[model samples]
Target: MTNLGTSLWLQPPRNSPIWQQLATTIQGLKPIFSDSENFEPHITLTSNISVNTQGQVDFVLDRAVAAAKCVPQGFQIHLSSVKYGSRFFKKVYLQVEPTPELLSLARICREDFVYMPEAMSQARNYQAMSAEERQKIDTQVGQRAAEWTRNEYDPHVSLVYSDLYPVEDADRRTIETRLEDTFGSGYDESGLGWKNGRFALVRCEGPVDEWEVLGVRDF
Candidate 1:
């Protein structure tokens, strides 16, 4: 989009079967929200890094690659639960169970891309926390994340996009109903399984086609 430094990543390779199942669920549920793009399995760590110019965007990615090279390339995390993120925006999402690796990586990215209050305000709708608030959440999340070793992770994928105003309960119910009808029925689950791998830096904002990869980072 218009914002700089916006990118998507997956920490580890997800099981094809589990991922497929999730994808199917997302596809079936897409109509409930604004159907823009097809769903792909990913855990979006950070989004919308503001860079006024293309050069700035490239610089950030280059630095991110260098910074990420120091860490190993893979880590295991559990997909724990499907929860509704109502605070930031009304949306249903799969929550990744907090892991030390995930938290560490997230913190590093946040620190590296720390922005001014104006920029921070722009990300409010995306993440409920402001830069200051995120620090606190990150600290607590980090502690809990560190304790996740053998435990199964709770990663909840969103099924619906909650809007500022939920027009009709029936409309919401209908969407949920459609998802259940499509996914609840026994469909071939292709991409649903255990996932562990590295995070790739797909693209940084520039010209849509002329984007740069920030390089993949291992957890």
Candidate 2:
């Protein structure tokens, strides 16, 4: 990775059979956001935890793996349903049925988030991130610590542009219509039961769109 900063993600196996099904839907919904398909698909462990070295990332991942306490290499996850509805931030999802391994991964990430605030201060532009924004970030991180640590962890991979606006607009409806035409409504759980195998560390590149691979841990 070129730049050093916060944020680490869990990139799923590159050549997995599951990506074929999920990619099609994710690609089809790309008009909603430019960054949706700009980077390889992934599920985040910690959105932001400051660090500046590949060694630190690998160390944290190793601990996270150990904290997992001998879970299976591939976790059996079931996609509950696809929904396109009233939520502003979310437009669609391949809702995950959180298995033990999945929950453990999330829990460990929270318990031992490798965030050195002093290190983060060096990386982050405090000027750009206003006091209010910093507070919000702090509050959100605190919330995730509790939320993902407990059973309240609602793990779901987004299928569309999560930040897209116009929730009730005609354009959104058109997208929704297309979604219905292609994937159908919330009631269908046709595609489920995938074994999520392997994990990679991704450095936050630019924004939420571009991500650079730091390391991989195959278990």
Candidate 3:
């Protein structure tokens, strides 16, 4: 909750019948990742702006609203596969098939959105990084951001939103097994569907309860 940045997200309909079920199911799957608040199911468009404070986040949002209006937003998302990393605290999520409109909108948003950088130091705060390596990061963050753009962007809707990190191997396996049990039932068919219309902004670092819906738009 300490690091501050802004991001754009496309939220599925809150009223959708499967919405509650999905959140509840994820929490029940494993206790290590459970939360009381129901996090909004979203596909991230742009995130981790280099702003330092909420005031700056507000400034970015003001510019983002108009650009968001210019782009269309009614693409039907197809969740086709389950994906997870062996790394600790990495989330389990459903892979989204990138459609023409979705791809186009991703490109458009990157071009239109403003990310005014006050600082980029927080990104390098890791134990393994040497001082020289961290200094190198100062030059290479733009390259990293590029991964989230164009053909490199891997679009997926996260099923868990926990900040738990450096998990042990046995714990990781237990969580993975629970996820397999919960969502591995239908690999052959498109798993579940939810109508998407709106996009919102929130602090990506905090708990679900700490997240605030900064702005919303419908297309």
Candidate 4:
């Protein structure tokens, strides 16, 4: 597999009650699926950051630091619903409310990191594309990233990454029921929310299990 570059993630403070609850829930969910991987729960702020080279890595690190400095305090992140998707990473997860603060932070990270010169150059199939095709793909990439940053950013904390288990409506309901039994219903009622958190620059290369954290910044 090709390296998918880096991503900016918003992670709940490890010491927070919400974090502990999420950690426990993620662990508990593993047995329900035949093939599932354990992963740290987080909300992706921005993805597809170009960190193919040492210089690109350093550049992204600097941008992350700068972005972190923009928000001196932690912001609230509320869990709105328990949902499931076909995507491996989002197979089953908690949907986060699109709070203004969260959106603002996402925008900042996107502006700082998404359109780096290295982004287009490090495309997965860059070597196979003609110059014109590369330019077209580059434009598409930029436009998609911008659109996602501005209006389509869906924040969620993933609970499982299993290709074998497809979460249907019934399965989603069961999962929701289990979560409610474990952590109560709403974010307010169950303390399923974070008041503040940190940012991590993760190298999302290879398989999901192999993803590595390059650096972190606390707000």
Top candidate when judged by TM-score against the true structure: 4
RMSD of each: 9.9, 8.6, 9.3, 6.0
**Candidate-wise lDDT, in order:** 0.51, 0.59, 0.58, 0.75
Q: What would the C-alpha RMSD of candidate 1 be, to one decimal place?
A: 9.9
Per-residue lDDT for 106 in model 2?
76
| Backbone clashes under 3 angstroms, per model | 31, 0, 0, 0
Lowest summed lDDT across 10 adjacent residues in model 4 is found at: 112-121
Q: List ranges where model 1 is wrong by over 4 Å.
A: 1-5, 11-15, 33-37, 50-74, 87-90, 113-156, 162-193, 202-219
Per-residue C-alpha lDDT of model 4 across residues 1-219, encoded as one tens digit per residue = 345568888889876877888888898888878788887879998787766666666676666556555655647788866777777777888888887677767866775577634565477777687989877866766665567766778889999877755676676677777788778766435546876677778988788788998877666
lDDT of 1 by residue, 1-219 (tens): 243455535544444555666667767765655522343556655555555555665565556555555556535556643455443222666556666665665555554554332344555553766778777655654544344323423334444533434335765667556544644532223222254544555554544346555555443
Relative to the unseen true structure, what is the C-alpha lDDT of residue 125 in candidate 1, on a scale of 0 to 100? 56
- Minimal lDDT window, size 10, model 3: 112-121
List the candidates' TM-scores in order.
0.49, 0.64, 0.60, 0.75
User: Candidate 4 at residue 15, lDDT?
Assistant: 63
Which residue pairs does candidate 2 place in steric collision?
none
Cα error of candidate 3 at position 43, Å: 1.0
Task: Report residue 129 deviation for candidate 1 (angstroms).
Answer: 32
What is candidate 3's CA lDDT for residue 102?
Answer: 68
Model 4 alpha-carbon miss at residue 49, Å: 1.0
Q: Give lDDT tens digits, candidate 2, residues 1-219.
A: 223255455545566656654566678777765544434545655555555787787887687556544654545556665555444324566566666677777766764564335334564675587789777666656565666557555666666655554345665566556655655564245655455455666666555456566677764
- Deviation from native of the Cα of residue 214 in model 4, angstroms: 1.0
lDDT of 3 at 158: 72
